[model samples]
Target chain A: MNEPQFALRIRQHLNQGARVDARVAAQLRAAREQALARHRSEPEAGLALASNALGRLGGVRGLSLRVLLPLVILGVAFATAVAWQQTQRVAEVEELDAQLLSSDLPIDAYLDQGFAAWLKRRASQ
Target chain B: MAEAARLAIALAAALLLLAAPPAAAAPEKDRRWSELNAEQQEILVPLEGEWDRLEPAQRVKWIGVAKRYPKMTPVGQKRVQTRMKKWVKLTPEQRKQARENYRRISKVPPEKRGDLQRDWAEYQSLPPQERQRTAPKKKPVTAQ
Candidate 1:
């Protein structure tokens, strides 16, 4: 019989309320456990790119989404962070240099903070 | 199949990392000392010795100053050149300190700025030993 009919027969057999010996009951429970294990995975979900990649490759056996998802996420985040940091560094240097070059105060005025403090003290006194 | 996907992702990430260096470095490579215009090379002469050693952003900033060089007053232009010459000689830590000092001083009132300038002149007039005594407290420049 096809799978549906076979399943129906097994269901009916179990519902018959017949008493079974210890060995047969244990064997049935083990078979059900194996069946449940086979059905452990849900349908593939999330991130069309990731899912599509696996789908196209006929899906990898036993590769958990739990691990793969985080790997993709962390890689993307870290790369983005690195690129942003470099750009900021370049821009900051450019603006600071432009301002320093354009300002009226002699660069020496800028080179020493203690001199500025001295100027402040001189002004106060 | 999922394993292949992981491999593909890793390869793609590797490619992205590989791609970043070329983009950042390509512009720097293009800014070789030989590539600068005659005027730029002249205006930035002070940097010539260390031009290649400078970061790409440094070279770009100096080039900008050269472009604006003609518009500035003679004194302004001279000041920029003098400042740049001294700037290139500074260690990175000293540069950081200079930047902090500049930012702080820029905020002083315009009327009071004259006083600060006069004090600066007086400070410069001090003997070498006196100037050394007045040196700013040394603070290590931490990377931002």
Candidate 2:
């Protein structure tokens, strides 16, 4: 028989409460009873809802950790670089200022045209 | 909607990284002569041809001096420019001697600096012949 005819005959037989071998019938009956018992014992909708809510919270926390950790590291690195640069610049400025102020020439003498000739004359002598 | 917001936040975070200026790859202390900024370059222009030949300490001093140049008054700036020109003309030995003399003078107490200034003024007022007579004579070089 064709596939449609075969299916229709099986449905009609099942509707008529057809009997199989005693052993096969017993096994089928036990399987159906077990499935119904499991259905009755299944978890409540409230319990499932609570578990889902906790899972969502955990997901958000995981997301925060993933994003936040890198950001903190980057921030620290940037701060350290800036601090180091500022310290270096300040030290440089201080040293240069000391050199400029402590020099013997009073700065203006170095600019005097006559001083150059004086230095040269002294050196030549 | 919540997922969309989280995604937007993540995008913002990523964009923040993109928007920030890149940190200097090398420290300012390690900057080469060619790497100097325009202002520094202009201020130290007389030293440009010999920048690489300068010692690290000298380079640092010049760069530091240039950095402070903008803070100086017009007269101070003019003095610095003239001094820089004079400094560039000195031989290495003369520069070294100048630095030593500066260090020695700097050690004098502030109150005593005036006395030193007076002595200098008296020396400056002496006649050339008299000044030469009092000046220290160089040791005559002997043949090996």
lDDT (Cα, tens digit) per residue for candidate 2, span A1-125: 99999999999989777568889889999999999888865744554555556558776433444355456556755665576576566565445544554344554333322333333344345
In CAPRI terms, model 2 is classed as incorrect
C-alpha positional error of residue B121 in candidate 2 after TM-score superposition, expressed in Å: 5.4
Tens digits of lDDT, candidate 2, B1-144: 644665665566566545443542222363467899888888778778878887676677677777667877676666666667567567766665555455444555555335544545655686777655543347533569
TM-score of chain B of each: 0.59, 0.51
Tens digit of per-residue lDDT, candidate 1, span B1-144: 765776676776777666666455322223778899898888888788889998776677677557667877787677777778788778889888888887766665556546656767888887777766555557744569
DockQ leader: 1
* Candidate 1 wrongly placed segments (more than 4 Å): A1-70, A122-125, B1-30, B37-39, B53-75, B125-144
- Model 1 clash pairs are A60-B1, A60-B2
The per-residue C-alpha lDDT of model 1 at residue B63 equals 72
TM-score of candidate 2 versus the correct structure, residues matched by position = 0.36
